[model samples]
Target: MSEPREITYAQAVREALRQAMQRDPQVFLLGEDIGVYGGAFGVTDGLLDEFGSERVRDTPLSEAVIAGTAIGAAVTGMRPVAEIQFMDFITLAMEQLVLQAAKMRYMFGGKARVPMVLRTPAGSGTGAAAQHSESLEAWFVHVPGLKVVMPSTPYDAKGLLLAAIADDNPVIFIEHKLLYKTKGFVPEEYYTLPLATSEIKRKGKDLTLIATSVLVARALEAATQLAQEGIEIEIIDPRTLKPLDTAAMIQSVCKTGKALVVHEAPMTGGFGGEIVAQLCASEAFDFLDAPIRRLAGLDVPIPYNRELEKRAVPQVADIVREARALVRGEY
Candidate 1:
């Protein structure tokens, strides 16, 4: 096994972007404040110095224009990685992504491709309020021609990002704001994790926890506490949501016989519902277990108050509470 070094999630993402641009001259980055200001979260810090202004260009505060321009550049033989300051602001760019970049290949009879990666910071905890802190991955996941990726660990963030940049299709890469400064072991060199794949973070037999983005960390912390009560919870991170690793999920659910889908998104129409439906449609449905549960954000806008904001999303205590209920047949 290769030795790993500790680094923050933001650093891992910056490293991946740096390495991708270095290896491929066609790859460039453009977004508001990404060049001189180092991005909204400093993920692009120092890139302007290393890659220069031409490749690390900055644009006006227009999400629609940024998306449109990147899509144009992508189809014209340039690999462009655009940032949307915040995932919530991506609403302004939905037209270009849904109509243009997503359908370019099919619309052109396979002669064209939009090799672009859209990176954005998502989730709450910084009290950024409603507009700045919404988990909207489900929106892009519903789009056909786009790939959605959310990495919980620093390692997966770097590896999956590299893969997304290299993919020929449009990829939506989501980073949790709370995860930015969190540290984990990551390789100094470049690596890529296959898209549409899921990884088992922890192994257990009592139940299977399928979480996304920031909730993955919460699930792991809950798993540790649940273990003391003789309840072993197997945690799975479906890093890529669109081409979800169904086989891995089915296999885990079959073994555990109980499943819990966790995410920071709201419970109503959240991505967790999709996962539960997928499991029910698959052969894993015959596992003969307790009903699958989804512990997600309350069906309300994120509040500016720190206490209310924390209550809006799933926390370690919430996971432990929900998992205990599911295992005890209390749900």
Candidate 2:
């Protein structure tokens, strides 16, 4: 094992892409401004010079074409990693992703595979307005064929991304805009983490906090604050949204007897709803001492004003307040 070094989340993603592309000659990248411009958030920076334009490709400002091209390449035996500048633009490429890439393998009776990755930055905090700052993972999860992954830390960001690239299916890899520059320790050697595994980040006996992406960090912060007041929260990060590790979540809920799902996506149709529904259907529902509450983004378009945007999503204080109430049976 190599010594771990601190690196930003964006750096970890770049390292994963570099390692994957180097290890597989068939793997190539295509996206708008990803070549010399180095990506919208600089996650793909410097790759064009290292691998040249052939592998590190730059396309015109057309997400539909970028996605369609990747799907075609994947079906033809190429592992193309495409980037949608922001998740908001994915709507333009929905046909290619939902209709084609997601159904190719089953449609062709396992004779064809779409081993492609669609990486995009999501979530608010940079005040990029409603269009650019939406947490739309639930949209992909609703589709039967796509694998949804949201990595909160640099370590998981690197490992899970490598796994997504290797999988012979379309993977919707979401990176929170605020998490990109956040630093964490990452091993120098290449590694892969299971895409279906959910990790219990912090163990507690009182309540369970299931969080995704940027909310994971906020939940952990809230956990620290609540610890001082005697409220113990077990934090579970479903690193992979689809193919979710329901067993891990169920076990945590069974032990704690209360659960609260937190995410930046709106409450009405967020991924948290699916988690709650699964828990309700499972035997974990019997173990609950109180209702499983969800602390999520407001059911409205994300606001462009910094203060209003912050209000739209769950915050550290919101988690602390909600956890306190849930544990006390006040919610």
Candidate 3:
């Protein structure tokens, strides 16, 4: 009923962290250079000054150590928000994240709760090269215990991050490196969005454009352009990956009778394949006008060359072109 408050994606995230810390003394933040450096991308710029080092801690460069410590604190009744710096570096802490944090509750017969949130900058578009620009959400999505969250808009980012921190389970919050500057509306009031709900960003009947992270923005742009050509594209953003909202996905596919899943991850074993399989596995397959389509990143290491890296991931032009064919029943 009223205009939403506009805010940058980074600020929305910062506000979520700040508010969570303020509300719960058990909630603290730990990350490398997050305090003094305000995070590598300045998302935690003023947190250190506000919450002090005890709560807004700056940890060593070891991701395993960071994750292990956070998990321990969480198990001991602390709501710890750990920053991974880069999603590509998650490999360095696979043991703590996958084995310990993810499996602790199940191994202990549901007696333990790893109320920790691992926030990391993920995906390419900033020319950070292979070691810095990786979309690794699919890796954790396969693990049953971990909750994987990837927010595509500022409003959802704030609410979801809050929900992640308040959870009694471990959550991997993947923030796109290229989406920090993107601005959107965020309510000043605090609220925790549901864990795995998918939101229909834009509605249409001809085709469904499903995307995640920055690709959601690209998909929205492509939808707008497709409208000019008399093709309406419905855009869906799965706010959480592990506990994916398959019901909404199936509903959208059933309504539109056509689906196009897009992502920044490489084609081979990318999560897009999982979505396609889920659709075909469901009754929604009967409603398709054509085969479900997938548009994903090229199967190659991210290049340091700006233009090459830009071309590697799904772009607006790619979504636009791909959505057109799906709506035309050409695919």
- Best candidate, lDDT-wise? 2
User: Per-residue alpha-carbon lDDT of model 1 for 96-158, expressed as tens digits?
Assistant: 999988898998899998999999999999988999998999988898999999999999999
- TM-score of candidate 3 to 2 decimals: 0.98
lDDT of each: 0.94, 0.95, 0.92
Predicted structure 3: lDDT: 0.92
* Model 3 RMSD vs true structure: 1.2
TM-score of 1: 0.98
TM-scores of all models?
Answer: 0.98, 0.99, 0.98
Provide the lDDT at 194 for model 1. 97
Off by over 4 Å in 3: 1-3
RMSD list, candidates in order: 1.0, 0.7, 1.2
Q: Higher-TM-score candidate among 1 and 2?
A: 2
Sort the candidates on lDDT, descending order.
2, 1, 3
Which residue pairs show collisions in model 2?
none
Which candidate wins on TM-score? 2
